[model samples]
Target: MERVPLSEVVSDCVRRWFQDSLKEAKAGDVAMQVLVGQMYHSGYGVARSEQKGRAWFEKASRYRSSVWKVSNKRPGLNASDSDSDEVKENIK
Candidate 1:
């Protein structure tokens, strides 16, 4: 069998969310899980697999809450000034 580079594997994985491979990754793996969901949701890297997309999206959202602390948001994480839950909650 031929071997594929790690980067290539990741690129292909990102290019498409294969159900079998998605199953191998735990829902707890937030980043990959989210990407899988995105692939389905936006048809970005995969077909418009909404069922799979929604499932993974929900999993990623919940998983994020579980692992993340309500701290200051950072720019690298794509945190915007308006993206703070605490700020939003406090405003209401």
Candidate 2:
């Protein structure tokens, strides 16, 4: 039986991390998008790809919301931004 090289194993793990993060980023996960961008920029989990990094950073920037708008536009953990009953009935 032959053993896999340590470098090969480590590279595989990093590549998997990149792939999983890419999936989340594609699904509108803003944090994951930024992470993917940073990973690309620093060659952390994948090869250094500055072009892809910039593109992902641009995407994350687009998703950023202003502080005032967060109350109205931010999605909850389940990815739903539905207004609460109190918010719906306001002026209380």
Top TM-score hit: 2
lDDT of 1 at 10: 82
Q: Which candidate should be chosen as best, given lDDT against the real structure? A: 2
Per-prediction TM-score: 0.44, 0.61
The 0-to-1 C-alpha lDDT of every candidate, in the order given, reads: 0.54, 0.65
lDDT tens digits, residues 1-92, model 2? 99999999998988888889899999998877776776777687788887887787677767653211222221221112223443666957
Off by over 4 Å in 2: 65-92
State the lDDT of candidate 1 residue by residue for 52-78, as single tens digits. Answer: 766865766664652132122221131
Error of 2 at 24 (Å): 0.8
Clashing pairs for model 1 are none
* Candidate 2: 10-residue stretch with minimal lDDT: 72-81
Q: What is the lDDT of candidate 2?
A: 0.65
